[model samples]
Target chain A: DVKVTQSSRYLVKRTGEKVFLECVQDMDHENMFWYRQDPGLGLRLIYFSYDVKMKEKGDIPEGYSVSREKKERFSLILESASTNQTSMYLCASLNRDTTEAFFGQGTRLTVV
Target chain B: AQRVTQPEKLLSVFKGAPVELKCNYSYSGSPELFWYVQYSRQRLQLLLRHISRESIKGFTADLNKGETSFHLKKPFAQEEDSAMYYCALSGSGYGQNFVFGPGTRLSVLP
Candidate 1:
């Protein structure tokens, strides 16, 4: 089965601390995305990478950065953790050949 | 600009009732539409796509280019069908930038 694995299912961080959310896909998809799922906002794109070392800012890219150093791994970085940043983060990978996107289990981050 | 809209935020239905989750999109070019579902405690997954023209879990969606809508429908809803549904649109370049709607929460009460 195709899988997109996230490094953490839950995380807690202190204010002003640096936070990293890792996502890895075994399917070797060229496009990977990071989205924040909120109550009413649904999924808001944070960042996305179509190729290694190439990234694009999504609708809500402020206070966040992304790294795609390798083909299988994509990391989302929070410059400074704040209460407002606490939300459910979802990782997804999609192959250019198809429109289907595989998603990770998601990581619920709490900034305290 | 590509945008998706799900008019209803919440819809409630009893068992064996018909259910329809509306989805509308605004895109200049030919848009690839999709319906994604998320069950309780489960990750979000694709429920159906417009291109496939197949039914899944008793749900199906039709892409209406004229109306600019792709709505999900099920004739008889089951209790297990309760979940969150999101409408998405993919532009050119093979879904490099996917836009999702606000999502509609379906509550199928037994």
Candidate 2:
């Protein structure tokens, strides 16, 4: 089975603090994505990386940045966290062809 | 722009009853539709895709381009069938980025 692991399952941070959420995939997939899921808003893409060091902004990328220094790891960074940034963050990885994406156990972030 | 829509926010049914989760899409070019399910305390997983045309756990979905819909259906609902169902669409563009709908939560009562 493909495994996608997230660094933290739950995190709480004070306002204006820097936060990082890490994700790693053992499948060596070329595509990785970061999304924030909200109750009524659904899963909105924050950022995605197609290759090492390559990134693209999704629908809601504000206040967030991503790093893909290596193929197996992708990191989401909040330069300065705010209360509104609290959410269930999910990471996913997919192979070259857009088959099925494997997701990690989401990290529930609480920005107080 | 490509988009997926699951109009219903919640759908409840009794065990052994028929169930259908509606999903609609809007895209000019060819579309690839998919259904993803997330059960309580479980990671999200793929339930079915239109291209496969195969039934999974007695659930099936047919992509109707004429109607621009891909509704998921099952003959008998079970307690295990309760989950959050999301409808997604992969763009016809090169990247194949997926756009997901606001999911529908299904509850199968006993």
Candidate 3:
């Protein structure tokens, strides 16, 4: 089965602290994405990487950045964590040839 | 730019009833659409994609190009079908990023 592994299931961060959310996919997919899920806002894309060393900003990339130094791994970074950034973070990978996309078990982040 | 929209946020129905989840998209090029489901405590997974034209778990979606809509339907809903459903769309590009709808949570009452 296809697997997208997230580095953490739950995390708590302090204000102004730099944070990293890591994801690794075993499917050798070419596209990786980071999104934040909220109750009413749904899943808003934060960033996406099309290939190693190539990244694009999604609609909601104001407070977040991403890194994809390798094909199988993608990382989301919060330069300075804030209370509003606390939410469920999800990572997903897409097969370049198909329409199917696989998602990781989300990481619930809490910033105090 | 591509966007997916799910109109209903919540839907509750008794077992054995028919169910329909609406989805619409706005994109300039040909759209690749998919329906993803997330069960409680489970990771979000693809339930079906419009390109395959196949049904899974008795659920099927028909893509309407003129309407720019892809709606998921199940003739007889089951208790196990209750889950969060998301509609996603991809534009015409290699490794295109998907735009997802806000999702609809289905509740099947026993």
Over 4 Å off in model 3, which ranges?
none
- Give every collision pair in model 3: none
lDDT string for model 2 (B24-83, tens) is: 999999888989999999998889888889899999999999999999999999999999
Question: For model 1, what share of native contacts is present?
Answer: 0.65
Q: In order of the candidates, what TM-score does chain B achieve?
A: 0.97, 0.97, 0.97
Worst window of 10 by summed lDDT in candidate 1 chain A: A93-102
Report the lDDT tens digits of candidate 1 across residue range A1-112: 6499999999999999999999999997889999999988889999999989999988999999999999999999999999999999999998677789889999999999
lDDT of 2 at A108: 100
Candidate 3 per-residue lDDT, tens place, B24-80, comes to: 999998888999999999999999999899999999999999999999999999999
Model 3, first chain, TM-score of 0.97
Clashes of each: 0, 0, 0
- Please report, as a value between 0 and 1, the fraction of native contacts recovered by candidate 3: 0.72
| Among all candidates shown, the one with the greatest DockQ | 3
How do the residues A1-112 of candidate 2 rate in per-residue lDDT, one tens digit apiece?
A: 7499999999999999999999999998988899899987778889988889989888899999999999999999999999999999999987656468889999999999
DockQ of candidate 2, scored on C-alphas against the true complex (2 decimals): 0.65
- The candidate, 2 or 3, that scores higher on lDDT is 3
